[model samples]
Target: MTQQKIRWLVVLMSLALIGLVIFQVVGVRETLNAKEDQFDGSVTEALDAVAHKLEKTEVAVLTSRRLAAERRKEKLQQIAIHDRPAKTEPKGRKASPRKADPATIQRYASHSPIVQQWEFYGRVTVPSDVLNRTNGTLTDAEMHYVEEYYRNESPPLNPDNRLRSELEKTYDETMFRNLRKDVESVKARRDSVGKFLANRVVGDRKAAPVRKHMPKEAAAKPKVTFSRPRVSRIDSARLPHRHMTEFEKAEQKSRVMREVLLDMFTNDRPLNQRVDMAILDSLLKNEMSIRGISIPFEYGLRSDDNPHDFIFTSSPGYREDRLLDGYSMQLFPSDLMATDNMLYVYFPERQSYLAQQVWTTLVSSVILILVMASCFYVAMSTIVRQKKLSDMKNDFINNMTHEFKTPVSTISLATQMLSDEAVAASPSMLNRYLGIIRDENQRLGSQVEKVLQAARFDRGEVRMMRDQVDLHELIETVVHSLSPQVEARNGVMHTNLGAKQSIVTGDEVHLTNLIFNLLDNAIKYSGEVTDVSVSTASSADGVRVTISDKGIGMTKENLRHIFEQFYRVPTGNVHDVKGFGLGLSYVKKIVEEHKGTIRVDSAPGKGSTFEVWLPF
Candidate 1:
């Protein structure tokens, strides 16, 4: 390729690489979001199902217990009266009438709301076993009361009053004896019902003994009744039913499976992890056509947020409000051969759609990310190959700077040795050699120190020895150290230490170094008319130390890299500023080590102010 084409290729390649990175980041983010959406949907479904099942179970348990209690009561009454003697009475009150009086039976039925329902199966007719046995016990007990009343029969002197008192006593004795029998009967009945209920509720039929005491015939096959009834609210009765296409049927089945699985997986998890209500509603509304049978059904959720426990139900009515609403179904009771009754399951549909919309957006985003990521990877490989040369150059420069530290240290040692009189012949020769060595050494030392400081700062090895120190004294000392440098460069140093002395806990040596570094940087980087300002005070958060200078000022680009090691501003038309770019880096490290924060406020062609905030 020609140089012009290669250069164009380089630019194109760079753009492509940037695009790829952006795509990858965006794609990953989208994928994660989509996964969360799907998970949430599945969880919502599961929680709804779990809650519904729990509620239904509780209802079932309670109902079973009630029935069991009734049965127990009946059994106990039978056992209590098994040995009672038979009773005979005058014609007006025969113990065993040929049949129970219709009026009396109606009156008894009226007293029991539950008993009226049994009329649907027809009036319960049998030999008067229950009443006859019960009455025999009552008659025997009443006779005993009557005898006692007669034995205690006595008159009060007042004729009318005596008659009333004797009658009251007789009535009281009869009631007392009858109440005793009734108490035993009721107790027996309650026990029987409780035992039956507990057994059935636990689904442990074996735990309860079979009702052997029930009359051989009454204990036989349970009788059931059924009648066909017109279903109300059939809007399309005359509309011809259509057969589902094969593909449509398969799709329906798939949807059902998905709904069922999602419901099972996320049931009763938590609100945040719930499934989309809209999807569940849609699934329920769609009629399933399987094996030429179209079974229309609705799935719903019922949350009974009983503080005692979390309960959810997924049966017809329960699912309506939570998932979908008002799903019409051609539902048949499971015991279809026997009971023929219909219950309309109503669901509130409004909230269902709201939950679903949120879920769809979340899931689709993830898919979008995956698609974008794939596209990004394809673009990345094509552009990444041609940038090898620039990459290598950057690496070489960094490494070269890193390795220059050894030679710089050796030169500094040699400069110190030459400056010593022991290594020189005369004072004049020593001074000349020392001057030469010092000049070269300081030059090398600045470069080496900058690189080493940058490296140490990056590796986090440079540590501060901290102690409680007065801000006033620390700043004064730093100002004194920078005074000589300021005068040598023909620059003036100014200071404004606040009136109240701020005592803070920090490393004095590092604080001093940090302050000196800022001053030195300002003087070196500034124009000939260098004006540096140093100030210390207590700010809102803590102690504030600011070093500001008016120099040639930095360009935005140069300012960006000012704190980078070996990143000297290119002095094309400007005077060379000595030293590697470790000044700010070292300052930044020192300030941070003292649990203080540093910030810079500057702009190109203006002054720069570096602020260090130390907590007191």
Candidate 2:
């Protein structure tokens, strides 16, 4: 395509690429936003689950404490008992049995017959063996003291009294110790459950392994069967006064147990305490993991009343004010089921996280842009190079046609003169015409030979017949041969063959042609009074030959491409110097074949220097 069209195409392509990039960037941004949103959603879900678990764990702990208290109460009740004081029999004959208290009978008369009968029967069937089986374990005085203490019919037992010791011996102080142990066990269970739930919240499988903690002996224990408590009915007349039926006693115990359970559920003390920092940290890490955020973080709790004070933090290095400097998330107390507190979590590597999420898209886009730019650059370079070569080729063809046409036209003119009868009659004129024809033929042959030689060198078909050659002798011969051309141009040629060791191994014919090409170029491009210099010098590794001319020198731009095939210095409408532009190219190829280096130095308004270094 034409240059204008190519430029337009490039512009259009660049605009299209820019548009595509913009569109893709927008799309990638949106996709990244969506991914970020998904991550945020996942984090929120994980945090919610942790909050729920924490709340549940707190409730469990309160319930365990309440249960422990109830157990202790039951143990205390089991160790103490109340009994009615025994009535004394009369000394006189057949003392009449004591009548039931009048107030007790009146109270029983207020209820239904069945209820009254039950109460009365319980009183009648009351155990009479109080302290009877433990005769050796406790003295009568100790027994009476214990019974009186439970019945509230005497002063309370003193820890220092002998009665207290006797009571402890009979009652087994181990029961109180057992009650303490049960409380401790309950506390341990609560702690273990709390830790387990915390571990679950953090996804720590190693924290509490179920199989590792379970005792093998537990599997060997026999299952115990449980039966419902049985209720008994009694006749009121057969029961003693101020007694409770078995059903009533069991009902009262059940009511106390229910109260304890209700208190357990209603307790809110656990929420007042500060949340466990380790558990909070674990929970944050778990949420981060679920959201695929692998970054270092710190967290702190802020109370609503004192927002500046952090009640708890993972580390002292954690700064609450700088929390918003990075990626931060907040959890309010309302969301966590705790006192008015806020949890703030900060991630230090927020940018890194974002980059990680979009690196693929960014890298791919950059690569694509670079590839496109590179392709465009290469294409433009190739086109420019091809255009330059085309122009040079046209110049070569025109110069070649002119060069050929000159010789052919001269030969034709000579032949036409020889064909004239008048010219044939004149012997000198005929001889002169014959000489002209021969010279033109020789010139034509030399041009054709030069072209053929260049082609052979290009195709690697010019085999060198290596032989010992004298460089000084070769330079002298070429200078002498070209001296006539220099004189014809009104120019002077100087040769300074200064090399002492000028003998080298090379093909003599090619070397001769190489020198001839250089000398010819120097003479051809010189001014009307051209002053050319040819010099030679010996070096440690090679021979150096230099050809210089005081002609219209070439610009630096032209010198750069001077030796390229078909390249010529621009001489604005001046066709005075004529050639196919092949002389320097051929010289360069022959010099290289002989393992030599060639270089040129020139500047506008100043002369040029062509230096050839050939190895010995």
Candidate 3:
């Protein structure tokens, strides 16, 4: 293609490549975004599952606390029952107890507000037989009293009041009062236990301490007043509770409570925390692995009310805002006590995740682009080199045709003159014409031989006839042979055969041709009055020959390709010198066949030097 077309093609290709890269980058970005969105969705779902699990765990813990509180209240009740004084018959009230009418007892049990209130307290124990008796009748006045009490209205001289007074005489008033006190004491213990659990279950040392509340009467009685005893660590399993004194029982109870509270608050907190973290890690890894995301992560719990304050963390160096900077999630506990707390998870290796996601696509795109670029460069270079070679070959053909035509034309003209009757009459004229033909024929044969020599080298058929030869003698003979050409061109030739080791093994014919080609090139490329020099010296393992010319010296660029086949320096439009452009190529080939090397040194506007080294 023409340079303009090639340049346009290159520009177009560059634009296409840039556009493709941009499009691919955009596509990759979108794909990554979509993948990130998918990953975020998965993380959200996994965190939600973890949050749900935590909520369930919280529910279980709370249920356990409620059960523990109930058991404590039951124990306190049993203790109160054990401490109550035994019931004794009243000495002054030996009078027969006024029996309640069957209808009255039924009325009180079924509908009386006072009896309902007593039953609600769970303190008063009434006999089932008394409520079930149906042997007596009620008076109209007693019926009126029962109706008034059930209506919660005041009555005039109510029979229900008189019956209550008689029943109070039969029942020990102090014992009832003590039962009420025991009920209050159980409630207080339940409240204390509730407070203890609330403060300790979550294992927060900064929490408010459990307060003690006692009634005024109980506070006044030192013996009856419940005091929390100091407890030291002990194995509850080894304690003999059955034979213990009251004080020892109290101490054992206190110790058991302390141990249970410590286990729940201290040991259980860390264990549960670890379990929660394990669950979170497993969920996160499973979700991320499914999506092919591998990244380092951290998790922590923080109060929702105070997001900056971390309650707990899976590891050190946990920052509250790390979640905001990278991939993260937040979860809230379902339990009311911990509803303000939030769990946060953070992923640190986000870049690695993105890179891994697109690594294959990126490599494939780069490789494809590089391969295309390399192919384009090679093709362009080959086209340019081939165009240069085609031009050189055309010049070579034209020069060769001219060289052959000149000799043939001269030979034809000489023969024509010799065939003339007038010229044939003189022996001198016939001999002169014959000599011209002979010389022209020899020139033609030499040109043909040079062409054949190049052809033999191309086919790898140029075998050397190895023999011992004197390098100095060879140089002298070749110089003598080219002396006439140098004289014709008015050029000076100098030789310095100063090598101590001049004998070498080589084909004399090819060696002579090698020297002749170099000398001929020097004369051909040189300006008018060409100046040339040939010198020789002994090398480490070879003989060195150097030929220099003070001609129209070549540039560095031309010197590089001077020995290439069919390559010639541009000499303008003037056809002053002629050649097939194979002289230097043949010279280099012959030198290499004999295991030799050639080197050239030249610069623009400066003379060139060709040095040939051949092993002795």
Top TM-score model: 2
lDDT of 2 at 568: 81
* lDDT leaderboard ranking: 3, 2, 1
Question: What TM-score quantifies how close candidate 2 is to the native fold?
Answer: 0.66
User: Candidates' lDDT values, in order?
Assistant: 0.52, 0.66, 0.68
Give lDDT: candidate 2, residue 534: 90
Q: Per-residue lDDT tens digits of candidate 3, residues 499-534?
A: 999988899999999998898888887887689999
Range of the 10 consecutive residues with the lowest summed lDDT in candidate 1: 197-206
Cα deviation in Å at residue 5, candidate 1?
11
Point out where model 1 deviates above 4 Å.
1-426, 435-450, 555-561, 573-575
Greater-TM-score candidate between 1 and 3: 3
Tell me which residue pairs clash in candidate 2.
Answer: 117-234, 117-236, 120-239, 123-240, 124-239, 124-240
Which ranges of candidate 3 are over 4 A from the true structure?
A: 1-34, 68-291, 299-324, 333-348
Clashes of 1: 28
Error of 1 at 387 (Å): 8.5
